[model samples]
Target chain A: MSQILVEALAKTYRVAERAPGLSGALSGLVRRRWREVHALAGVSFSLEAGELLAFIGPNGAGKSTTVKILSGILRPTSGRVEVGGLVPYEDRIRHVARIGVVFGQRSQLWWDLPVLDGFDLLADIYRVEPARYRKRRDELVSMLRLEPLLAQPVRQLSLGQRMRAEFAAALLHDPQILFLDEPTIGLDAPSKLAVREFVRRLNREQGVTVLLTTHDMHDVEALAERVIVIGHGRVLTDSPFASLRSGVFAERRLHVDFAGPAPEITMPGVTVRSRDEGSLELAFNPADIPAPQLIAAITAQHAVDDIHVDEVAIEEVIARFYDLHDAREA
Target chain B: MAPLRPYLAAFRARFQLLLEYRVAALAGFATQLWWGGIRIMVFAAFYGAHAAAAPISLADAITYVWLGQALLALQPWSADPEIGHAVRTGGVGYDSLRPLDAYGFWYARSLGWMLARALPRAVLMVLFAGFVLPLVGLGEWAWRPPSSLEAALLFIPAFVLMAALAAAVLMLANIVVAATLNERGVNSILTPVVIVFSGSMLPLNFYPKAWQSWLHLQPLAGIVDVPFRIYFADLHGGAALQGLALQAGWTLVLVAIGRLAMARMMRRLEMQGG
Candidate 1:
């Protein structure tokens, strides 16, 4: 059985609607109107133990709502979930004891207290033994290179520094599963890379199941073996990273850095995206013309040097996918 | 009994957080002293003329004002702003994921903040009013202990507990307002109530004979009046014990209600969008 199991999960929120303007506001006080919003229509997935899955989606695509439900924070309007053979919301305390969650935008540490003090408080809260807690804190502090920051107040730490502390704080209890909600958001490139590396090690070495939701495509490529693409509160695609990239966006890019000034070249199916002094980029759907065929056709016309081929960026793929989805819905 | 270590750790953490803002505490001390002086001038005028006709003597009245000023931090004037903001911004989502019970955790922390705010201020205010002011020949205006220092000191534990409970009750109430009414509504609902009934403005007797009984039994009265009355030996042995019992009773009831409300509010809790 998978460590995390969710099926046909759905959630709707009842948001109060206030009329605009002074007259609308006055009438709203007498009797407010409410509109039901379906945050999750039907999101279903299962996570096997030791799996690192990246859940990707556009904003308001229910990525968070889905994560919240799985973490036992929000109740689903409909569907079933069994995380570690326990219904998270129903068995909250016991379930929460076994799972760690890091919300990138929120810090669990006391803002005014030193980072070490917050760790100690969390240790008490999680009921971690003194010996084990010390060992774990030392290990994580060194792992994240947080020893120099141990005595600093959290409010004084930079966003990157705080997130590192947050990661250690979440893991102090030695939870079997970790949920990272946009863990790399707003991080500098090196910080993002460090976080990705840490999460990869945590998943691979410790066999810790990680469900990472992020918008940074590089994070997905670096850490996740499988990617789950969600849109409109439903699973649009789920497969191995390589397969998902090809399946959802069969388009690929070819960059030819010429020996000198680049030549303007276009095939029947290929579109020239940009041209620079010594290079040009092309976008082509694999279905329109196989990448090899396009390359061969390209070499037939101009001298090719330092040629590179890559898939379309995940952001662009998702954007075009959403445009297709919205167009279909409209 | 529940292991108190976790609660104690929370308490210590909260205390440390409050102490970090030492400048604010100093400002608070100055503000309370200023208020103390004004109350003295006004009450001295009222009592200097009618000392014979008053129920509480001039000395007791002045003591009441000083003690109220010193112990002012103990009142549940507002919800624990951190937890309240967390709930408002949905930061509470991560907060609720913690293993601790929200009620006990917040209660312990809130009590910790109050004690941190109160302990030093209370000591300094008492020393300044009782010792420094009197040394300057202001004894008539300074705070004085009642006939028995031992008895007054003895009742302090009960008063502090009562005040902490009142704070918890008020903090819990603000959650309901914050979750439903948002942040503005929290200020609108709580500000007036904290100022009026919490005894910061004036004593219950200052109102009217008709409202005295009800006013004295209020949660704020437990915060200021009951504690000070015990210190003044206004309510002796049996009555003092009864007062402590009543405060404890109210605490249990209010905490229970607060816990249930918290559990219910969190059941469908929502916060800042992920």
Candidate 2:
């Protein structure tokens, strides 16, 4: 059975409307107007146990709305949501107790208290038994390598340190499902890798079902096996990360460094995207021409010193995919 | 056991957070001291001129001022800014994620804040006014301990109940602020009204006979008037029980209102895509 099942979920936000300028502001005071913003328009998805699903969307695309509903922090305008066989909003307290959530931009730890103290407080909040709490707390601390920073106040910890602490805090109860919203956002390269690796192990080893939402495509590429692309509050595409990369934008990027001057040689399938003094970049659809043929053609033209080929950056693929999704809807 | 661990932990956490900012409490104490000094002088002069005409003896009036100063931290109004900031900045989303009931969690925290700052300042002020200030020659303007042991016995329970009511009322106001999201209106409207009407600015007895009776019926009177009357021997057994009943009634009423408001606001927050 699926650990999380959401069917035909919809959420509408009643937003207060006001005209611009002084008169509009004053008129709003007496008689306020409102407009409805449909955050989610009948979204549906399911996550089997131990699945790592990356939910990708643009701003206000309802990624957070869905996550909130699934985490039991939000009530849907309509439709159904269940986590661990419990209706999230209807059985909010019970549903939430079984799932852990981490919003990247928010820290759950108390700012003035030491990191360990925040952990203790969370242990209490989750009602973890004292002996179990101590054991779990120490295990997470050592796993996260949080020993050195345990005594320092949360305010004093670096953002990277704080994020790690947040991860440990959210896991203190050993939640069956983890919902991470932009968990790697605003992190340095190393920190991002650390978080992604931790998430990967948590899913693979502990079998914790994860629903991740992020704008960072690297995070999606590195962590999520399946990607759910959302735009305008609708699921645009749901497929494996590899297929999504090639399905919309089928081109692979090739970088060639010549032994001498780069030649302006034209090939049937490959198109040069950029050229410099001794190196040239090309894009070619592998469907039309295989990568080996393209490389052979390049070697035949130029005295090659070094060559490399990479799939089009996932970020660009997503941007183009969003454009396709948006155009289709329009 | 249903497990008091979570609420107790939240309370302890909140107390520790307030403990980090004792400077704020100290600043509050100094401000209250200055205000108390001025009120005491004004009341002492009035009672000296017309002792028979005064509504309370000079001792009771001065005691009221000092108690007001010490207990100012316990008011529902002063903590509104913190709750406002949390809601406006969207930080309260984390709070909503916790497993505990939102109303009980915050109520415990509010009480923790009261105990952290208000309780200590109260002890200090009572000691200084009862012993130090009187020996230093402000005899009638200093605190007079409860007249009989019976009064202290009555005041303790009343004081505890009043604090619980204040916590509930403050939590209710915070839920209103969260639901409304009108920080400026609450700041400009709610705070001033609470400060003026809570009898924190001036004791209700100072008002005319007709106004005093109804003013005692207000929620803030349970916060201030009930405790002071018990300590000052101005209230006996029946009246003391009545004061306790008023606080208990308000506590029950506000707890109900607060829980309902919190549930409604939580749904509203969810609908708003919190």
Candidate 3:
């Protein structure tokens, strides 16, 4: 079943046009002016039950705006968004109860209160029954390893510690869907890995539908099965993560080391990307010259001691996707 | 049983947060003590020079001053800045997403916090004033003390209603401010207004009749008027109850408007993109 549906999700903002200097500022006071900026333009997508989808885009690409609309905090300028068979904005109180949201930059916890107090308060805010709240809170505490941290005030906890508590707090209601906006943006290396591992387990084992928006390509590579690339307030591409990377920009690098000075072996459909002492890097399109053919070409004329192939990084693939979309639009 | 239960639960959490500030709580009481002392001296200097033939008795005046000082911390306008902060910081997004009613949550939280501050100050002011009143020779060692029996009946409800009224008005004012500006801007404008109109700086009686009449009709004066009238005018029975009713009426009216405005503004808020 489709768990989320968004159609033509457009949001435009009327921003006050303030002038550059004192004279313009004085003039603006007499006659205020506004210019409309379309934050999202006809965005549309759908997610099936228990799907792990990574929503990625550059800054100001409407990633957070989409999340906000879906979570019921924002009403779209014109669009239809149905989560769990209800319009999120119209039935916000009912719809929001079933989903949880976590923003990496902000915390939902009361800063002066202990972590347990915050979780307990959330239990009340979500109207979770005492018995159910207790059971779920305990489960989340254990899952997030928040036992020791629960007694400390939210302000007292370190960022990593606080983030774990935040994740647990959002889930204490046992929300069916989790919307994480850059959940691991500024964490240290180990903390980032821990969050990634936890998210992976939550999606695979628990079947909790996860829609995560992030700048980190590694997070997408580590957790998301499908990727939705949005840019300029539109979804440019949506496909399986692996296929999206492989389908576009198929240039792969093959580095071969020879026992002697590298031979300039030239072949059709194969171009030398770079070369170093006793090693050469060749770029080739698999459609024209397959990896095996390229390897054969190198081995045919050169005494190759070692060799390895590197596919394009996902970041490069996404950048190329952006360039391709921009070029077509232009 | 349905929505009320969760609101109560949230209120309990809010209460806990309000009382967690031990040092601020103590400092709050100390400041009330200082103000009480200074205001009592003002009354002393007046009674000391003039012949004691005024309609407002020295005893009643003394009690009024002390309670007014004590009640300053309990006034409802406390929640306005919080609303402003929420609006300014974009934290209102998370709050709006919660299943609770935005106005009710803030109103309850403000009431809880006022109780936290007010309860302590009330105790210390009564105790310290009890000690100092005699030394100053202000009547029979008690400034209109209702005996132990009347204390049980009138003062508890009086303070509670006062706090609730204050919270409601403050929350309403905050909703208006939140719709337009952030907390810092609201605080800058609203604090002086609260100080002037609520009679925190001086009792409404001290103001001219027209000013007093205007302030009395407002939500601010409504919060402070009942407690002041009950303590100073020696009003009881129907009149005192009516004062309490006015406080209740204002609280209900303001809270209703606040809730409606909050719901409307929350709908219009574009927190994520803005």
In terms of lDDT, the poorest run of 10 residues in model 3 chain A is A321-330
Which regions in candidate 1 have their CA more than 4 angstroms from the true location? A18-33, A255-281, A285-300, A303-310, A319-329, B181-183, B198-200, B205-207
Q: Which stretches of candidate 3 lie over 4 Å from their true place?
A: A249-316, A327-330, B49-55, B77-81, B131-144, B147-152, B210-215, B272-274
Q: Candidate 1 or 3, higher lDDT?
A: 1
Docking class of 2: medium
Could you tell which candidate, 1 or 2, scores higher by TM-score? 2
Name the runs in model 2 displaced over 4 angstroms: A18-34, A255-268, A272-281, A285-296, A299-315, A323-330, B270-274
Candidate number of the best DockQ: 1
As for DockQ, the candidate ahead, 2 or 3, is 2
lDDT of 3 by residue, A98-207 (tens): 99999998899989888998887788788888899888888878888899998899999988998899899888888889999999989988888889988888888889
Sort by TM-score, best first: what order?
2, 1, 3
Q: Whole-model lDDT for model 2 versus the true structure? A: 0.83
DockQ for every prediction shown = 0.68, 0.63, 0.61
What are the lDDT figures for the candidates, one per model?
0.81, 0.83, 0.78
Arrange candidates, best lDDT first.
Answer: 2, 1, 3
Backbone clashes, each candidate: 4, 0, 2
Comparison by TM-score, 1 against 3, better one: 1
Chain A TM-score by candidate, in order: 0.86, 0.86, 0.83
lDDT of 1 by residue, B1-274 (tens): 2477777888888887787777877788889999988988888898779777676777878888898888777876666676767666676777668777777777787788888898788888988998998999988888886658756765777676666667667657666765574656666777678668756677666777888878877765666666677788876788778667767777777888888887887776764376
- Indicate the worst ten consecutive residues by lDDT in candidate 1 chain B: B177-186
Taking all chains together, the TM-score of candidate 3 against the true structure is 0.88
